[model samples]
Target: MGEVTINNIQKDESGILKENKKINALEDSVENVEVDGEKYDLTIDGYINMQESEEYTLFLRKSTSGDNYVLTNALLSKYPVEEEEQDELFLEDGESLEETEDLKDTYQELYQEVLKE
Candidate 1:
């Protein structure tokens, strides 16, 4: 087992929680931060979309038996900006995900099958 570094923890003037942490390799696995545009993202279920320039107040809990931290209340712990306040971050002139009907789906289907087992 290995450990990652948690450096700084503070809040911005807008009350958004900010953290400076370095992801280190766990066991033999390599780790790094994922950045899209100007935003940082942590892969959750490998399906949740990461919005650029989005801010959230994340409530996290460190694992009692491992070197990991997870959202305290699934997604309820991470509250995004109000819809009105998020309008600018999503200016129509900037980047966007094109509408598509076909795409890869992960976990959800398999989870349903497993549940029926």
Candidate 2:
């Protein structure tokens, strides 16, 4: 007589045997976020706290996707830093303003009106 081995498994919708396991939300923690094998840096821009439900949510923004935002759990530690400001450059000494013929005529009329005042 052959011995029988029993496995605590069930077939899924696809007919594949899958082991049953318990999933606990408190034990789950996000270690790192990545897309296409590249790590994505998300910045915490805002937050929402629901005292009634005792839930806290964090809003994050990514520079790669301008103006787009993402929401994640408050426990996430990967936050973005403020970007540095760039200096502005004005016209040089040799640079001059370009005006069209219509603009020149309008400016002359305005100048005459101002002089009369």
**Maximum-lDDT candidate:** 1
Each prediction's whole-model lDDT (CA):
0.36, 0.28
Extract clashing residue pairs from model 2. none
lDDT string for model 1 (1-117, tens) is: 233343345333533333565332222112255566454434322223224455443445555656554555432343343332323322233333432111112222333343353
TM-score of each: 0.30, 0.17
Error of 1 at 51 (Å): 3.9
TM-score of 1: 0.30
When superposed on Cα atoms, how far off is each prediction in RMSD? 13.7, 25.6
Worst 10 residues of 1 by lDDT: 99-108
Estimate candidate 1's alpha-carbon lDDT, on a 0 to 1 scale: 0.36
- lDDT, candidate 2, equals 0.28
